[model samples]
Target: MLYPTLRPIRGATLLLTAGLLAACALPRVGPNKSEIFAGSVLREGDAFVLTVDDRVNAIAAVAPALGFSAGFLNAGELGADTIRAGDTLGLTIFENVDDGLLVPTGANATAIEEVQVDAQGFIFVPYAGRVRAEGNSPEALRRVITERLAEQTPDPQVAINRLAGDGATVSVQGAVTAQGVYPIERPTRSLIPMLAAAGGVAVEPDIARVTIQRGDQRAEVFYDDLFASAANDIALRDGDAIVVKSDSRTFTALGATGAQDRITFESRTISAIEALAQVGGLSSTAADPTGVFVFRNEPEEIAEQLVGQDVTGPQRVVYVLDLTRPNGMFMARDFAIRDGDTVYVTEAPFVQFNKTIAALTGSLSAANGVQDATGL
Candidate 1:
């Protein structure tokens, strides 16, 4: 009976000790600071880890330019008076003498409204025959008609007025107040005006993006950028397809954060501090203020600038942000968090120690109870 009692106590002690040993391997949201740094290139790790300094901040602050190219910026504004195919024209012909070719007898003047231009860009008049109207101004078309009718009637007077055409139009759709095909008129000749004509964008201006596709050319810009710079208010073209939509850019927040999820970019550009704030900031009790990290895939050119080494294509990069330093918060504020980035905060070192101690103490207490029960 004594041997059996001692054996039970020994068994209980072994079980408690094993439970304490296993406490170091507790489940965690992600790898800790030491594990992350150990994997960096400096420590024979897979990624390049760099501290966020002024130079690094400036280098990482680079964002993709969002605006039209030379083609869109350099394009001349469309002439509102110019007539295109499928447009409607109003024509009036007058002759001083009676029995004029175009004007009926005793009428003196003949007015024809809604004279639609055919697909071939031609408009037909009774005696004037077919006349090319596309690419011609209203005044120019009037001159062409007056000269043609003069052959049949002496000093024929012609007046031509241009109307909204089916051609030279753009299709506006997606996230606009109104989505429809709108003619490029005097008031809606450019990007911003056309958007206004569509009742403006339906989404927030900070996250709105406008993309214009004309044949083979395509360009995109932030909705706010259209007002920030005049050059972004690009000229509209015939058959142009304009789409306004909310930005699709997002980043993942994980590890000791107040919230762990994918967060959208509220603005065209979001700094690290802003991103942290968006996710409800870091966990007050569990987060290591010195272990905030941003993981990203840097382009070769940017990676070279960041690491002072020659790298090609996409490079795995980890940017360390220490909030304990005096400039740490400013560094975080200045650091740019890009799309598809992962923001992770490691746990405080004492958190693991506490977890281990708690596990050991709980197991020891359970073992003592087991020993007492088996003391028969």
Candidate 2:
């Protein structure tokens, strides 16, 4: 009679323990709506929680625009024929007198095959001394040399011929069909043409980014924009270094997404709906459609616009989308997903409840098996 009484009591105790454990620690993809909202202003949490709406969507859409800056857009034209340092010039000094300087006896003209411009922008002739070669065309440089040689020689005539130059070249590297140093000539004087000289970009045009670094100034623009507007085709300067690369902007898909991974942007800008579709959308069996969230550290300016107040540095923001609502789909369709964001979808409430009931039932079944084994 004692054994019979103890058996039912033991099973009842096991069932109660399992129920308590399941309620306390049910596995979840992430925080539920109540838990996330607990940290809102109404609660003690510091993160700015916002429900997705048209006004919030518009405010958050003001992302950092990726395009050429003023320094790049307002660039002046670069003279294709202008000489620069390290250029190779051919100088021919013609003197009327047979025994004149810079020319062999009986030879009226002296040809100097290669006259390299020094780093200081000066070139040295036999009698003309040092003259500035950079920033002058071949004809302009010839006039300067003639004046210098006229002092000692009678009726001195000078001619300058520009040869193949290595000074006025731009280096193209990164994701391109060809990577090398190319001369800035008639066809390759501007940004777009220079990129074409490298056999165009190796990556997709929609996602390619082209950056131009000239001395201390730097600017970047999308490759597709170069053709979209002619103003974006800024002139290329000497010593300009161009890099063509695939856009590195990415967002992470976590929690109940069909695929949880960091995905690259397929376009220059990605909306919330587009980002979800890229990751195979939410899991049908586990995802809570109402708990879609975007986690980001918004810049101070954008944060102020969203909250309608001043905020310092970057502020923690969590944007929520409830698909159960009528306007939820439209809000998600318009909301922009910025770089370095985490797109998380929480599991449905019923899913966790199901797990708890399963846990409790399993515990009770094990207790019944024990009773049967003991023949009680």
Candidate 3:
């Protein structure tokens, strides 16, 4: 019966065939245009290519393209560099002869102890009584302690050292092997040591951004860049917070390419050439070398930057790269692929034509069979 004939077309293969037929009915994207693209898109020259020099210039600005630099953006005047309340201190008050006051002036007198600075930031001492240890360097505390002892004892000496575990702490959070508020126990010049202590970033350091929040100031920089540039690796301050955010910036690759997927930039920046290599290069047989384009929704001001263009909205900003030409390779070297870019490679015209013929022939054969069965 008619119902039995239709029943044979209700399985997985039939469903797949139906899906393909539906797809074939819609207009496929060509080399020049895309369904998602809009407005009057300028070609390679009209749109900016973004050379290495351009990136260098952009990096020097107040805010860079990929992210912001913490040290460069810090505008607060230099604050007092000292310990805060709740910090700890290790004190050593030495007496060469080991004889003094409570020790009976010769009963072997020596004390080495660690004390927590009270909420008020005061630490108790034998002769100095409760003295302020907060907001003072170890050296500064030593001078104050020595001065306090001079009045009561002869040849008095004092040395103060800030304890790391309970004092001088920095908060490390986000994508890290270990995340917690860790103390700057040892001398920490940059974020590397602190990151190491916390078991480093959860992902590859190259694929993360380290955001440092000091006081009210907040800025972010790529973790790899932070280590590469000495200036970027500024010392961590007390109460400073650091987060290792996964690289959020990404670009898409589609069409006749070795791989088609959303690709996140591993480093601070990457050029179009590098991006192509990352995606396993274009599909050698089916890809049209002349149809490689990078799509972006550019800012309104970009229209002015390009000459002879009727640009409108943020819908269209396409950069075409012709790999077939000799100089095209050179131009590609300077073309920087920004975050959220769509790198598309159109299928070869011959391949598209072959696909169209195949789809049409299959559709005709199915229609004839249906007509024959219906006796029309």
The lDDT for every candidate, in the order shown, is 0.87, 0.86, 0.68
Candidate 1 clashing pairs, residues 3+ apart or interchain: 39-45, 40-45
Best by TM-score: 2
Candidate 2 per-residue C-alpha lDDT over 1-376 given as tens digits, one digit per residue, 9 for 90 to 100: 6665665656475757676775688677778888888877558788899998999998988877778878778878666677898889998889999788888997889899888999999999887789998877787888889988889988898888887685478899999999999977778889888888899999999999989888988888889889889999998888899999999999999988889999989998889999999999989998999999999999998889889888889988999998889989889999999889999999988898888778777767776787678776
Candidate 2: Cα lDDT at 274: 95
| TM-score: the better of candidates 2 and 3 | 2
Query: If the candidates were sorted by their lDDT against the true structure, best first, what order would they fall in?
Result: 1, 2, 3
Residues forming the 10-long window of minimal summed lDDT in candidate 3: 55-64
Worst 10 residues of 2 by lDDT: 2-11
As for TM-score, the candidate ahead, 1 or 2, is: 2
Candidate 3's residue-wise lDDT over 1-376, tens digit each? Answer: 6565655442444455556766765344444333323323233233443222343223312223444455543433222236668766777666656567434565444565668888998888877788888767677778888888888877677767766535567889999999998766554535778888898889877678888887777788778776566566566677789899898888999878888989988766687788888899988877888778877666655533542345565434566677778777766666777777899888777776776667756766786577568764
Task: Kindly provide the TM-score of model 1 when superposed on the true structure, using C-alpha atoms.
Answer: 0.86
Please give me the total number of clashing residue pairs in predicted model 3: 0
